[model samples]
Target: MIALPFLKSVAPPLQGKRIYLRPPTLSDYRAWASLRAESREFLAPWEPLWAVDDLERGAFRHRIRHYDDEAAAGTAHPFFLFRNTDQRLLGGITLGNIRRGVGQNGMIGYWIGAPFAGQGFMHEALSLLIPYAFTKVRLHRLEAACIPSNERSIRLLEKAGFQREGLLRSYLKINGMWQDHLLFALIEDDARAGK
Candidate 1:
């Protein structure tokens, strides 16, 4: 959860061959707004119900503040995906709900604009993010949960080496209704072993 006049100290970007992941800034409002608005119908089924002012500039600024606060507190990291060639915002991913000390883990959440779906951008992002989660963030486990009907996400997680754990009944609210999710996890040991 974050946005715009750009964050004062932009986080270092995680680079990939075709994409990069960096924090979203004020400069991204137009592209982000257009993409989300255009893909509203496509995203609505999977995302939480949007607020009446979800796309407003003020809301985005507030989101960025929250993101910065979380990051500074070591609780979450949020990033926007961009194309290497053009820097177009493809989507966003975040490692949230980080638990430290005895529970060194975090939850991953992501979204790709409809136009960029099925093109492997997210896979590339995860390839970069997972290692960072383990080595840089020093996390022991990474978790992801997707709506039961989101076959694309299910496949993506599996392909990224996450093992299916189980189902979470009424795990989250999506589009105004409670929905179940399939829980998946990837542990540091398995990742280091090249799983």
Candidate 2:
């Protein structure tokens, strides 16, 4: 296990009405891998192609270590969403590329399990996460980018108060192809406006 000297300074688990967000743990490998496997087809178009060992336990441990390091360094906060009632893993969200001082900004990314998609859980999770990001993480701006063809993600970001800012040409590589993406952003003021 990696030691996180700044663990206490990191944002705590966020609790919401229907879901809660916490960091991924070693014990989560089985469920995480299973869900990813089942959702592979549903998620492929929106994500980078997975490596052959992506779901292996060793990979998961490495991921956990990386997450801890990022969190400790105050560069990112990675969380796994769970249903509040049963604690079933539903999805994940990450506030990555966190920048402080003059910027006070971060990029948000997320993915939901196929079985839990379209059920308002991710929406709820975002509701909880946004507040935490602004207040607890002390972030002024949060940004997200999604493939223009991904209507679901676009809608989700809009619903979560992210305004469509613009488009990027060949912004990122997804599923082994470079793709254009729509950029969305939310500032602290925007969230305060209840957008």
For model 1, residues 98-158, the per-residue Cα lDDT tens digits are 8887999999999999999999999999998999888778889999999988999999999
User: Residue by residue across 2-95, what tens digits does model 2's lDDT show?
Assistant: 7544334356888998899999889999999999999999999999999999989999999999998898888999999998889999889998
Candidate 2 regions exceeding 4 Å error are: 1-10
TM-score of 1: 0.94
lDDT of 2: 0.90
Show how many residue pairs clash in every candidate, following the order shown: 7, 0
Taken over the whole model, the C-alpha lDDT of each candidate is: 0.90, 0.90
Q: Measured by C-alpha RMSD in angstroms, how accurate is candidate 1?
A: 4.9
